[model samples]
Target: MLTTTRLDRDDAAVLVDGAREKSVEMGIPMSIAVTDPAGHLILFEQMDGAKVSSIQTAIDKAWTGATARKGTHVYNQLCVPGEPTFGIHNTNSGRFSIIGGGLPVEVDGEVVGGIGISSGTAIQDLEVAEAAVEHFLKVQANQH
Candidate 1:
């Protein structure tokens, strides 16, 4: 059987807190979601004043990142016109997204989970998600 790192509740909480801090620093409310490598929801949060519509989008972003094993922006580049993955969003029952703000969480070079943020501009969301992922990596490194 294949073995890989998995995200536990404490790890999920760390990611959520990191994302929340970045969102607050940026003065942007956001919806954040974390998911396991298999795309299973591990935790989710919606900041006050965040748009309700972003809840689902955040979850879907995390799911896409975990399952696809790539940042959503990478998918966006691949799905552009005349690109090899053009129209790839049509797969996975349309659950995949090519927008920014989705990122895989890696531990020792293996993806353990994914984080996604929404309810702000794409850049803001990506920044928050990236901040969360970076914090998680630091925490994991210190644990060793």
Candidate 2:
């Protein structure tokens, strides 16, 4: 049998914390979601005043990032008309988001989880998500 690694509660907590801090710094209430490598939700947080509609969006973005093993913003480019992956956004029961704000988390060069941020502009969401991943990596590096 092959050994595999997945994010646990501690890891998910760190990711959420990172994203929340970034959102606060930006003065934007946000919905955040973290998912395991299989695209299953590990944790979710909705800041005060965040948009209710963005809850599911955050989850879906995390799901897409985990399963696809790439940032969802990349899909925004490839999922457009005439692109090879044009219909990718329609897959996974529409859970495959094609917008920004979803990012895969990797450890030791292996994907461990995903983080998603919403309730702001796509660019802003992406910024927060990036902060989350960066924070996680820094914490991991310090621990190691």
Candidate 3:
């Protein structure tokens, strides 16, 4: 039987906090979103001075990554010209934010969820998500 693991509110909050802390340390205000393996929202937050427009986009990116089981930017990478799934952004009703900065959160060698950050530059967004990933890895190692 196949099974799936979902992150509790606490784990998801840690994931968001890790991302937010990194962003602030880098002098960037941002928004962070975390989702379960199935891409349902677990928790989300926006830092002071973040753009109001980026809230849902942040969530969408994380949700898309978790649900699609791939980075949202893959849409740009794999959505080649003439690809049937190209322009999925339109097909998906704007839920697919085909951009960098969304990353999957894995545990036990499997994706338990995902993290997404926005409101800063694309690279900043990546930095926050990467920080969350790093925290997850380090915490998991400590549990051994």
Clashes of each: 0, 0, 0
lDDT (C-alpha, whole model) for all candidates: 0.91, 0.94, 0.83
Better of 1 and 3 by TM-score: 1
Model 3 residue pairs with clashes: none
Off by over 4 Å in 1: none
Rank candidates, TM-score, best first.
2, 1, 3
**lDDT agreement of model 2 with the native:** 0.94
lDDT per residue for candidate 2 within 1-144, as digits (tens), equals 978799999999999999999999999999999999999999999999999999999999999889899999999988879878999988978889988999999998899989988999999999999999999999989998
Best by TM-score: 2
Q: Candidate 2: which pairs clash?
A: none
TM-score of each: 0.96, 0.98, 0.89
- lDDT for position 118 in model 1: 93
Q: Once model 3 is optimally superposed onto the true structure by TM-score, how far is the C-alpha of residue 38 displaced, in angstroms?
A: 1.4
Error of 2 at 112 (Å): 0.3
lDDT of 3 by residue, 19-72 (tens): 988988998888899999888899989899989988998998898778777777
